[model samples]
Target chain A: MTRNETVDVLIIGSGASGAAVAWSLAETRMNILCLEQGDWTRPTDFPANGRDWEARRYGDFAISPNERARVTDYPVNDADSPMKVANFNGVGGGTIFYTAHFPRLHPSDFRVRSLDGVASDWPIDYWALEPFFAENDRMMGVSGLAGDPGVPARDPPMPPIPLGRTGAAYARAMNRLGWHWWPSDTTVATTEYDGRAACINLGHCTPGCAQGAKASTDITYWPRALRAGVKLRPRCRVREITLNEHGMAAGAIYYDADGAECFQPAEMVILAANGIGTPRLLLNSASARCPDGLANSSGLVGRNLMLHPWPQVSGYVAETVDGGRGPMTSLWSKQFYETDPARDFVRGYTLQFARGAGPVAEAVDSLAAGRLPWGEGHHRAFRALLDHRLRIGIACEDLPEAHNRVTLDPELTDSDGIPAPKIDYRIGENTRRMMAHGIARATEIMEAAGATQIGVSPTLNSPGHLLGTARMGTDPEHSVVNPWGRCHDVRNLFIVDGSIWVTSGGVNPTSTIQALALYIADRIKQRLATLFDPG
Target chain B: METSQDSGLSALEIDALRRLAGVLIPPDAALAMPGADDPDILADLLATLGRDQARVQAALGALLAAGFAAAAPAEAETLARSRMATAGPEAGTLGRVILQCYYRDPRVLRALGQDPRPPFPGGHVLEQGDWSLLDPVRARTPFWRDDRAGAA
Candidate 1:
């Protein structure tokens, strides 16, 4: 294979964590290279630019890589998993399809073991990462109201997204029931922040934001990192991370866009591939020196997988809520976000309120739900739910379980002959109980909001929050990565992604994922003197 | 069960689709909303068949084989309901495509009080709601537990 010139730092995956760390380390003047498997996404090429925008969600912009099946996407064997793997392989990664409903993990989230006594506590607490959360928020241009009593008080860079008619309806319901509800901390800019424009109240925030308002890393950090002199080479699919005689990560071998095999050497390697991608790479890079995996001395590299179980409850209100006029989630409730001893479950869920879908989606989904008939009553049923429906999506916290893991498929391989990652996951009893409670609560709220008819999607299979496959902890014997995100076995290797999470919080993980990346970058800078010293 | 060369749909199949579409969603004179088999909507649906050609063809063939075209309007409706109850892959595809195309029509969108154009450059305006609704939530004390409040 071809050998490229060595760099000081080699990073893989240019999505949320990758982009943040690259930007953080750029000021050091060290040669930093990020190899991305997918090409850049142009805003004009987003689905919103076409009349068939809603339709494209099921096609090109599908959250599942198996369904999208782009050349850059590697097939995932999720047959054994009730919750399918949802991810994007492009420059922005899953952020490209995220709804931008950003919320930080509560302080209690880091102390799951201490508080609820379920999952292991994070090596680093929420206080350790609080500053990084603020820093990443500035870079990503967060929009939210301050003093949300659920978490700590902090001002966002921009005003909170407007609580339109739909949000107002839900807010009134919460007030009637005396439940806590707050405007969601969304990453979409309310006013023009940085160089991006403000959102125009477009119906669908996923399928890529044509408005340039949503903070996908491609439009958020990647541009700033590029300007800071971070070298990014796209369309280079990494096959394996190579190790030197000393068993340190020497570099990575990847296939370029032309399908030519080449090795990009570096002094240090950082993995920013998400939970599944990161573990898949580690397992595929196994060698005689480390037969199980590169950092498998603990045998925890691909263990403790957690995919948050999200259940959606929706119903039709009496009046027009104008559901197709704005971002999906403008408000959420932390009413059941913490532990309650009386409840059967340990950790709770966040109720994220969403506006209704557009005409096509509304018609299709309503028909399936039996709310809209297929005969003469179709028009009346469709008219009732066209713009009057509202939904509450419960983001249930998933405790880490060793059996719910990502393992290399024995037979399935990508086009490049790399073994695909197979997921074996089932909703645990705790999550099932949580979902039941959450559904009941959501139905109650909808009824209080004066919804005439209600529908429940008990479980959403594609939650897109892939986390905890390579957990971080203080103990090297139980975790794949140490507190500062360094592989316990590989001295010069580090990981900065959702894969390092110890527990899945009830809110969206993008905010915490970026904070962890920024925090790890700071730690790496601080320990530059003895960065490669053996543990 | 026949297939045309260009549109991947036979003339007979297109007629069958019209009959099936009417049974799927009939015209409503009260609201002036056209059915899925409206001439314009049927034309658009047929024109857009290339988007998901193989699946749509299979679905149409299945419906036609089930004698939906040969049956009376009431009998066709009964047959459609039974097929829908089963929700087989072919029935699902047919239902989804018809509804998707039906909702895209300007008349349908207008009747639903939505702008006919795509949600882009001409995005709609949403008036902000009462921010005082959050007063109660904001008045409450912080509920998050502090894990390291007294730590050095």
Candidate 2:
């Protein structure tokens, strides 16, 4: 429709990574366009009631304009497509509902292949990215303790969250087990530093923080970018990245808010659309010149999909602990974070303790645990046990295998008329052994803590913290992007999200993603003169 | 009956629940709040519960019965006695089960300063530890300042 807009840089997906990059480059004076497939929802818009919140949690009655622009609901299967990745569809992307657990990857995590011979080593080391990580931490207002023995030492911008009953229990357990557990390095403000209020322990971080305590990108980076004059187009789903004659990124073709076709030209394109969408968009942008997929000369556009296998262990306590009343998870132990040759698994796993069971979710759990659906006895049992249940979750690192990849299913197409990302993944032997070990340790801890009953459940496709689709490496044959997160085939294109991760570290990926985004943004800024001069 | 014990299960509380249930039900349903003798009282409430004694005890309480029938002295007394009888550990597994369900019901949850909508907005029972983790954060500015200050 003869729609054309030009900018110095175009960022697809205003998520944790995209927003961070946009914010970092805010003062560059370069024209930047950040497109998000979700609407800009404010904290005040969240529902106060539990049922209404639950409905929104399931993405029901979400802002419809954004929904039509992007296909939010896609099926998750085990054999063909099995990744329960719940990404947010708004200006902030999944950061809106993400538990602000921003932990940096351990230094050894970068050189896993050298250290443990389990996974491939990252092209970039932790030292190279440390400055960016520190910068990102300060910018994002991370609250944590400095000099954590488990990882490198860095001063947190804010103080850590206080240890509550559960944290105390977890700490005691860790002490007894002689494991190294530390306060989570989260993005939530410990004290009133920024304009945002401090955490109130509302325990509803997943459905979006009404209290503005959880540090989502909207509250942290998006505002900074907006203030810096970075143009953010919400409800704009990028369909394809158009290339020039020289094979550089010309611009992007996207569906605007009204579902109309629009093309926005840019000197450079930084794809932070996440692992799944980033590769999907690249594959969809195939032309006669780039038939194998955009910037996919090595034929690894959507290869090496990695998801941190999540296995949960629930403990039923005797006292009315009220586990579900606070944040998602309060305490974590990285004692097993480093791989042990003594253990059967190649990679290690972290043990995180979270308060358990919202009423409805608790009911479902109870039903699963053989609680009778009805009768006086059933009701009594439910009430007596409601306050005493606690759950321990392990975000076990899954080794990257070439076989576990994200490919488009030729048979099924999403509502957006594009093939849905077909995730072919299974928990490898290393992860299964890790899960079993972690569960055994968790059961021991629970029993030691006087748990009357304990249950463990481990599944392959626990979607939240996804990584390693388009891995970064020194050689283009083995990876999609280079050590600097720049596309090996296309210099003008960059990937700063979880997609560029070479190894899925045991911790949450947000901190690492944000750090990489900052590093990449710095590189882009340094080369802005040559890249965006348009000579 | 001791008057002090009777005060806990006020006649008014029993009457309020009876009215509340009526509002929850569809207007088209002919099912009135069954009387004590109405065989369906056990069946209707226990139908969804199946053979679970806990569900039965929790659902077959003073507040639940009030919603089914018009307030009467005998009904109130019977409901109060049922509640007290199940209050003890001697009330067995069945009694404990019902007690738990009753407490979790939306009506009771609201009365206990809990928002049933967010389920447990302040956090769930297990969330106490999570709250503790946020304590360093919460101590600076509490999550429930308004509620703590007794302000709506």
**DockQ of all candidates, in order?**
0.74, 0.12
**Alpha carbon lDDT at A259, candidate 2:** 74
- Spell out the clash pairs found in candidate 1: none
RMSD of 1: 2.1
Looking at model 1, residue A281 earns an lDDT score of 97
Model 1, span A320-417: residue lDDT tens: 99677899877888889999999998989999999999988887778777788878777877778888998889999999999998899999988788
Model 2, B49-148: lDDT tens digits are 3234333344445345544345475555455445434444322323332333333445545533456555333533332234333223322221111111
- What TM-score does candidate 2 get on C-alpha atoms? 0.78
Interface CA RMSD of each prediction in angstroms: 1.2, 14.1
The runs of at least 3 residues in candidate 2 whose Cα sits more than 4 Å from the true structure, single-residue gaps closed, are A48-51, A59-83, A371-376, A458-461, A530-535, B1-105, B110-152
Clashes of each: 0, 60
Q: Which candidate is the best by DockQ?
A: 1
- What's the CA error at residue A229 for candidate 2, in Å? 1.2
